[model samples]
Target: MQATGSSHSLALRRGDFTTLIEALDYAAKGDTGVNFYNARGELYATSTYADLQVEVVALARRLLGLGLEPGARVGLVAETSPHFVRFFWACQYAGLVPVPLPATMHIGGHAGYVAQLRGLIENCGAAVAMAPVEWMSFLEEATTGLTLSFVGTPEDFDRLTPSTATLPTVAPDSIAYLQYTSGSTRFPRGVVIDHTTVLANINDMASHGLKMTEQDRFGSWLPFYHDMGLVAFIMMPMATQRSVDFLGTQDFAMRPRKWLEMMSGNRTTITSGPPFGYDLAAMRVRPSDAEQWDLSALRVACVGAEMINPEPLKRFAEALAPSGFKSTAFLPCYGMAECSLGISFAGLDEELQIDYVDAEQMQEDSIATPLDPEEAQKSKRRVARYVDCGALLPTFEIAIRDEHGNDLPERQAGVIHLRGPSVMSHYFQEEAITRECLSEDGWLDTGDIGYLANGRLFVTGRRKDMIIIHGRNIWPEDLEYLAKTQPGVNYTDAAAFSVPSDVDQQETAVLVVQCRERDEIKRARLVKTIASLVRSEFGIDVVVELVPTRTLPRTSSGKLARARARLDYLGRRQAAKMQHQPEPANSLPMDEAMPQVRYIA
Candidate 1:
């Protein structure tokens, strides 16, 4: 199948419409649309914006014919296919809130996937649920104990009769979608986003973050369930009337090269992912492949979702330099689902900037004192680096507050607070959790610890994941980075947190490294080597534990689930306490497994 053309006859728009249906109406007037690439980097499906508009409206009529309420929730298994895109827009036209459930599946972890799906199904109180043909059995299994009006595939939904009733009027205040957080728990919290909120974010992003042009076409392997994927690639492109290309998230993981191939062959100008995605792509790309790929038109490589790592980005640029990839195209951005996707984004076409600061003063006094890299090397004090996440959108109001909620001055590290049009008002059916983060006067406690310098946001660490010992705060990313520097340790292999030890009730920092080595001696040495490095670097003793590869749990969006890992550590210790009782000869080991990674917990 031929993909959509890069240039369209229709005039370009920058997310100026009031609702998604309105935006789709405008985009459908153009020839630009979305293209889906298979695992082999070949285009398999193509849908022009006009075709999408006509098809979804019909699907909307069919859905409304089911006699479901206007505001009924539709649980959709997002698998990066045309079906998901169709169903998502159909719900929008039908005035139904489409909840994109994760299509991610762990190898041989069916039970966990079922539990997660069941929890989400019940959490959102879905009126209807649909899955792809290949995933139908799992969906049936997950919905076994739940009650829903309908549970079937897209074809099944299509088999229904069309309604004679007119579709509901699309409103700006109406719920557009329910975006679920990739939490560490079985039940993920859904962030409620309306038409106004989402459009405001999209407008700001297109005008500022991307600085999109008519020639710009987007490409990504990010899952549809992810904010960056759903908002940036799909919605942003459609809203701006630009064509976009997509490769499955699983396809990219298995063959990261396909993403590059598609981008180069299609001349995609915009794409994004977390740091690990770039690292994975760099690892998989060979020198010969780079020579054959022509990526001269590729631009705007946005990075966020976690701490920015310059090393992998640099490697990716260097490897693809022959293919015409420029390092300055890397735009470091910061955002969350709570903000409708974008909060702050770096300047377009600019190099990703880093700020080096005195780690000691910052950790102790909550002050971000600037320090030169050379001075840091000479001085005995530790140094920390934070990427410049650019300035907040013009529509946002930002503040930095200390632990006691007192306002902090510039460069003072504290909890970042924001009030913006796109900020989510509440979590679906989660009032208490909503109040914990969002305040009364419209300010949202982002739960991210960061400081502002010259109006730009530089995120340090997550407030909830901050490791404190003896009144000193430590960024877990710092410890994890150090552990990853060791030999045989790949990126995302280390998870660091504070835990209570056997000797004392107070918390001590622990770094859990996923070691693939089976030899006890090598494993011990790897553990000890990291332990010594941490002690010398921070002047504090840090416990190091080596677990099997893939032991660390990851969120659905492919982020390391540190929160879940911490719970596993606690559960393992609790199990060890019970194991302290006299045991049999062939009993299993305590340190070998984790909670949902399922043994020690």
Candidate 2:
């Protein structure tokens, strides 16, 4: 199948418009738009700018006919399909706020998924909710008791009559969409972004971050519910009138090789995914397939969404080297939903840069003291490596602040604060949360621990996920990484956090590992090996528990929800204690007793 471009090419327009409607209107005059592919790398559908304009306008009229007021929230279950794209733009043209809800449902997580959708529907006070035909039942079940104006499939919404009423005029400051945080689905907060705010971010990302050009073609398997997927792949490409190719998130998960195959065939210039995506693809690559395709056209493989693990990326770059893939193409970036997608990006055409700092000093004094190469090689000190996330984007200000809200000096780890035009105005309808995160002076507390050295931002860990033990700071990721290095431990199969210490009131590290071995002896041995590895690596005693595969919870975007896992573990421990039952030694069920063994050095 052909790539996403029309026969008649038009000159590229790089952020010349103010609003999304205006941007689409200008893009319709050209030929570039969006294209979709299946798991087998076959094209399913293509929507040009001209085709979108016609359908969006027609759908907008029908949506306004529903008698919903301007600025009303329209909840759209964000499936990776053309319907979501149409409905999203329809809301923009009709002056309504579109709330993209997560469409991914985990196995045995139907009830939790329904509850999450219901909470978002109630929280946004959505006037209407629309899902694809396959997901209509879940949406209906989610809104059973809610007072929504309408709830059905996109086909149902399309069957509405057109209204003669004039559409409301959209302003720059008007709400573009409500982006819910990927963290904490139980209490999701919708970030309020205006047309101008998103446009500013898109402009900066396209012009400065990716350095977009007419020849640049975007491709991805990122879900539309995510800010990186929605803003970077969908909105940014449309704003620049550049063609983009999409593979369904599930399809990519099942067949990651198809993503690279399509990119190679289409000569895709830019694509982005979390580090896990690259790691999975690297694991599936064969030596013979290297000669089957060319990947030299891939200039920017933007990596974000979760912790930036350099090992997997290095493996991917090495495996694809014969196919002309450059390791320097990996653009490590730092961003959140609150910032409209991007905060800082690594320099273009540069290899990944990592700073090796004294780990003990960083944990105790919060000082990121860089280690000399010779000293790092000879010294017996523990060192932590943090990826350089590059400089902040132009027009953005980043300050590393202490607990007292004072700015910290360079090389000192502190809370990351941001001030920029693209920052969200507030959390929709959540005044208390909005006030807690955003200051009156327009600075936002990012809730991430990081240090700035020579203008580069180095993310250390999450503020809430930090573990303090014996006046020492331990990042969960550090422990998790060590656990994953053990034999039989897979990437993302382990979660590390702190629970109440059995000997003292201090917090103790706990590592929950998912094991496929059902044999009690083997599972117990695996747990022991992991505990030993953690103790040897970090010099800390840990409680290791093995659970059935896929027992650990993940966020909608597939990020390990460590905080939630800790809570679930504690709840199960409490329930088991109250039941007076013997703890299972191997393959413990999530709802049952959690068998814990503390390994003391």
Q: Which one is best on lDDT?
A: 1
Local accuracy of candidate 1 as per-residue lDDT tens digits, 1-601 = 7899999778878999999999999999989999999999889999999999999999999999889998899999999999999999999999999999889876338888887888898999999999999888889999996879899999999999999998999889999999998876446789999999999999999998788888999999999988888888878899999999999999999999999999999999998988899999999989999999988887899999657878888889998998999888998998999999988888877887889899889888988899998878887668888899999888999999988899999999889999999999799999999898888999998878899998889998878788988898888998999988988899889898988766777888888878666565666667677878888878778877666677788888888888888887777567756868532222322354532121110
**lDDT tens readout by residue for model 2, 1-601:** 4555722467777766789999998888887889999878899899888899899999999998889988999999999999999999999999999999999986347898898899889989999999999999999999998888888898898899989888789999999999988774247689999999999988888888888888888989999998988999889888888888899999999988998998988888899988888989988889788778799999999998445889889989999999999999999999999999899999999999999999888888999999866687687777888998998889699899999999999999999999999999999988998899899999999999999999999998888888888888898888888878877777878888898965676888888887666566766677777778777767778888776667788877788888888987887677777988655543333332444422233
Candidate 2 clash pair list: none
Specify the poorest-scoring 10-residue window by lDDT in model 1: 592-601
| Candidate 2 Cα deviation (angstroms), residue 432 | 1.0
lDDT of 1 at 397: 97
Model 2: lDDT of residue 426: 97
